[model samples]
Target: MTPDTLNFIIIDDSKLDCFIADKIIRNTGKAGDIKSFTNAATALEHIKETPPPADAKTTVLLDIQMPVMNGFEFIEAFEQLPAEIVGGYNVYMLSSSINENDLNRVKNYHSIKQFLNKPLTSSALAAILEEQAQ
Candidate 1:
């Protein structure tokens, strides 16, 4: 898929954070469809039930500090999906927590592109987009 046609899925427990990210992503005019879920499990279900088009590239912004299903847990579940379905997605873990363990744990997941700090900014999004462009 072309970079300009990239879609997004944001999974964060905080509604405000999700709203902020949705607005920031929209302002860049780089996203196609942006869907946000306060629950990681529900987001996972959506991905499993309704996969994106084969040519579409979808980026997942997952928050690490959630109640029911945390980012790590989500990653575990996400990895179980079929390779073709998982191939269309790029997961980036987002968290406000500075716990050394949390930061270190992200490295273990091959599917996780990077770990980003909370409150997704335009610059960070731009960098991510630029990376995807290549």
Candidate 2:
């Protein structure tokens, strides 16, 4: 999808990683707006309050590991959201984790489109867009 047509949300506990990922995403020149959150709870609240419209293009890049509420916990909460809001989102797990168990566990979330290794790369981003386009 074109950057101007998509909203990107990056949730990671590390400030530096969030910054770097934001930069990479901006470099693609396809992101309409990018929002970053260091905590999952706050992000979850925003999502709950302003759930994307059903026809809007939105993608969330979430880190698997975070203090308090991890990505899985966020997913659990997200799964309970109204279908109208949830239908507009494409959730991807973006993490530095290489654990087989962690990777295997993501399959439980039907909402997650894919589990991506970070830091996010241009090629990987392109692949995501391309795949989604198809």
User: What lDDT would each prediction earn against the true structure?
Assistant: 0.92, 0.86
Candidate 2 runs further than 4 Å off: 1-4
> lDDT tens string, model 2, 1-134?
33345678899999998998788878877777789999999998988888675455588999999999999999999999998777778999999999999999999999999999988888888887776655
Tens digits of per-residue lDDT for model 1 on 37-134?
99999999999998777776699999998999999999999999999888889999999989999999999999999999977899999999999888
Which residue pairs in candidate 2 have backbone atoms (N, alpha carbon, C) closer than 3 angstroms, thus clashing? 3-30, 3-31
TM-score of every prediction relative to native = 0.96, 0.92
Collision count of model 2:
2
Q: Pick the candidate with the highest lDDT.
A: 1
Off by over 4 Å in 1: 1-3
Model 1 TM-score (2 dp): 0.96
Best by TM-score: 1
